[model samples]
Target: MRNKPPYALSSVDHALHLAALLQQEGPMRVTDAAERLGVAVSTAHRLLAMLVYRDFAEQGPDRRYRPGKVLRPAAASAAPVALLRELCLPELRTLMERTQESANLMVPAGAEVRFIATAESPQVLRGGDRVGRSLPAHCVSGGKTILAALPPTELDALYSEDDSVDLPRLRRELALVRERGFAINDQLTETGLTAVGMAIKDAGGSPVAALSLALPTARFDRERLPGWVGALSSAVAKVEAALSAR
Candidate 1:
């Protein structure tokens, strides 16, 4: 019988290395994995597919891959989630105290935003924003901050041809956000609730999450929105810096 090629052994080694890297790092793309492994694109793609099939990794809507539940048992548990909580809690508390509004730390999950952590205000009319709640990505301030950070090509791919072709308007709005360093949703997600948000970029300047403050429209004065925006922006900067420094 013919001897098995050395490439097969190399492929197995590369896949194991990639899996270990994903467990250590956060989410990444196939190209990123290939670059890190110094392997061909096709090889990385195959490895990722196998990992996904075996439930060792999960693919996000943006095509990035993250470690799946199957890998959680062997890996150190609770550290990643605890790190997120520890980093976000103080900022969320500050935002709540400053604005007297609900504050949240949201991350992209598939096509929606998931509230990883939240701090509720003591106001009588506070909106109850709970953790683990998922919301449409296009309809919330936090979601908009994340969506606006995506490249034009990725943004275009997000919307369908039959859907509202409002690319020009969207681009203009995002440009304004780029200038202002934040995003706003005026009763977009729910009636009488307005939110202001800032994106949280990782060390590489990629938007990994967003932070936002939500208040009732009755108390959302246009004149006072700037102050809230500033508060949220400051909180976001501090959190991003802390995360990047780690």
Candidate 2:
């Protein structure tokens, strides 16, 4: 029988145990994680956040933790996630430079969107890098932009399985997003954050990901939104062109 080491770090042990639970037992809520690990809710949340940052876990639309890329079985082909991040970094940087706000590259993962790369603004009061973070598809600018591109039936089917969002409200917002060819999040995910996003489509005319610019809510100017969206759209176009070339 394997014995626990006397010097085993409890925090590391807890994180590993949590990862094991996600991999073997599937998705679990933070409360369930806390109960299983015998830790406080805040402690469990911190552990899960660390796992998410390391790609050992991801939070879904239902806000349950699940095994991430690092824990999942190997894919048949080269993982596109890495390639997308690499190819989009330059564009993200350009967008950040143009808008003076943080730029991010995200891809839809089921009913959630995962932040894979970020280029942070140099301003002292700017939005920070959000790489490795995940949020519900209906809650963030990039997620909404990606979702707005979905086929009507597919979009309806996706939210039908999850009851956390207001279907009618999301539908209305997505309709506006489609009309404008971009999406905006005004303190939707975090209280002080605002973001604008546009979809990046492949040569086949299918959206593969989204590019967004996030700023502090205090700095958001509706008067300047058109300029910001224009810059974001240009960056997306460049990224899409590169993807097509590849």
Off by over 4 Å in 2: 1-79
Candidate 2, TM-score vs. the true structure? 0.72
lDDT of 1 at 171: 73
Q: What is the lDDT of every predicted structure here?
A: 0.79, 0.86
Q: Which stretch of 10 consecutive residues in model 2 shows the poorest summed lDDT? A: 72-81
Give the per-residue lDDT digits (tens) of candidate 1, residues 202-225: 787767788898888888888997
lDDT agreement of model 2 with the native: 0.86
What stretches of model 1 exceed 4 Å from their correct place?
Answer: 1-82, 161-165
Which clashing pairs does model 1 show? none
Candidate 1 has its poorest 10 consecutive residues by lDDT at 72-81
In candidate 1, position 88 carries an lDDT of: 89
**Quick one: how many clashes does candidate 1 have?**
0
